[model samples]
Target: MIKVLIVDDSALIRSLLKEIISKEPDMMVVGTAPDAYAARDMVNRFTPDVITLDIEMPKVDGITFLDKLMKARPTPVLMISTLTAKGADATLKCLELGAIDYIEKPKIGVTEGIEAYRQIILEKVRTAAVSKVARRTSTPATVKQQSIISGTEKIIAVGASTGGTEAIKAFLLALPANAPAVVITQHMPPGFTRSFAERLNNLCKVNVSEAKGGERLLPGYVYIAPGDIHLGIEKSGADYRTVLIDGDRVSGHKPSVDVLFQTVSKTAGKNAIGIIMTGMGKDGAAGLYDMRQSGAYTIAQDESSCVVFGMPGEAIKLGAAMTVCHLDNIAKTVFDYLNVTGSGSRL
Candidate 1:
């Protein structure tokens, strides 16, 4: 059985989390704590396989606790946060600090919301239990635009889930200022994507922003799919445009990687480059295969470098990936492909 520890400042939240987790047949809540101090004690006694940590607390915040925990024990952590701007920022920091993932507290109907998302919460806990936790690592040297052969017209499409934030950051930070246009779906909720995109924009050379429908795709820019919406690509005259759709969850997620990859295959065809990174499940597997069959270059993040290795592994199994590579090599590989093929140069 999967053992879990709940760390929160609220008795109510702790009880609610326990109730939700206890319903899972494969998992059990080993203990609960109302603060980080109590949580530290529980961690020693329970030795849980996973932890659900709340961001707000009376004394030590979740971020500090996570940093300490990763440095010491390296246990998989899933953060619980309020659906606010500060909460979003803190959650992103937690991810960078080696937390596995996060779930936002409902703003309106707390009970109903928790019940509605029970499955997702359980799935995250299961993924966290089996996740690979390691010390934080930095990206390699910055990308040089001049070194990349000019006139590569490639449009890159990427999809990720579980452990994607850090993976995507490393890939983008290594891109040149004139890198090809890129679009992504990272399986985040609304209100969080804007903060994520803004954070990426501040850190990376590429101009990254949350996608708003109808924007023309351009080089040197990366558009991230907004939460709770589906983002697609379409051919418009001599250029490509972003299409945002609000529909039922495809592959159990809004802004699914499958949706993005399918759209890219249909719209950009051989001009696109598809990449599936570290994530849980097979959301992008078949769509990536379509991209490969349509003559686009496809790559998967290799198993050793993946946090979960589910999505990319499925893609590799399905013959969707033309090549599988480490996270550090992905940027250079994409650039090398651009240098050689120049797929989108004439478009």
Candidate 2:
């Protein structure tokens, strides 16, 4: 059976979680805590397979508590967050600190909708239980300054979901502006992708923006796929550009990573590098396989460093990845690959 711990300040919330989880034959709520202090105690005693953590609490907030837990014990954690803008931001931070996934709190009179949340929670917990956990330490100076190649018109394609927001940040912040042009597909709600891109742009040296139709793929700039459409890469004579394809969902995601990776394989071919980060599904595995078959180098985040190892693990199992890397090493690995090949022109 999968053991779980629920850490929330609300008694009602805790009770509801227990009720929901108890219905599953293979899962059980082994412990409950009102705050991080109690959570630590439960961790020592219960040794749960999963933790459902709340963002707001007295004495210790969820983000701080999660950081401590990951540094110490490193179990999978799912966040319970309020459905406000502030809550979304805080939950994003939690994902960065290594929480596996999150469920939004149900609104008043919308309790029936919570069944979906319960299902998502249960599914994430089960998936998290079997995933590999990589040991994470502070970024080393050598990794921060690593470069791929001196002068290549390089392109990096990244795909992520679930716990990707923070994973992307951790990887990108370590990248230099001169690295390459980058295209990213992160599973997100509408309006949030732009905000996320803008936030990353401000924090990192490279330019980051939400992709628009026909935008040129320029060095030192990162284009994020819009939430509701598929973003593809196209080559026009000597220049590569973004193409937004508005269509039905592919693999249950609008901007599916498979679609993006397939496009990159066709357009950039051996000149590109594909990085599949942490996420909860198999969206990118087939496309990543295509990229590898086309001679583009590919890397998958290792199970230990992933929020959910589903996507990368699938890719690795399928022989799509050339290397399985930890989150802190991913940026440096990209640079190292590029440096050996010189750049796009050389390739």
List TM-score per model, in order. Answer: 0.95, 0.83
Off by over 4 Å in 1: 106-110, 145-152, 343-347
Pairs in steric clash, model 1:
153-344, 153-345
Off by over 4 Å in 2: 35-41, 58-60, 71-73, 111-115, 132-136, 140-153, 303-307, 326-328, 343-347
RMSD of each: 1.9, 3.4
The residue-by-residue lDDT of candidate 2 on 293-314, one tens digit each, is: 9989999999877867889989
Listed per model in order, the count of residue pairs whose N, CA or C atoms clash below 3 Å is: 2, 6
Against the true structure, candidate 2 has what lDDT?
0.83
- Model 1: lDDT to the true structure: 0.88
Worst 10 contiguous positions by lDDT, candidate 1: 144-153
Residue 16 lDDT in candidate 1: 77
- Residue pairs of candidate 2 with colliding backbone atoms: 133-304, 134-304, 148-335, 148-339, 149-339, 152-343
lDDT of 1 by residue, 1-347 (tens): 99999998888778878988998889999999998899998998989999999998888988999988888788999999887778889999999999999876634345555556787788889999888884587667776545444343468999999899999999999998888889999988888899999999999988999999898888888999998899989888888889998898888889889999999999888889999999999999999999999989999999898889999999999999999999999998988887777743653
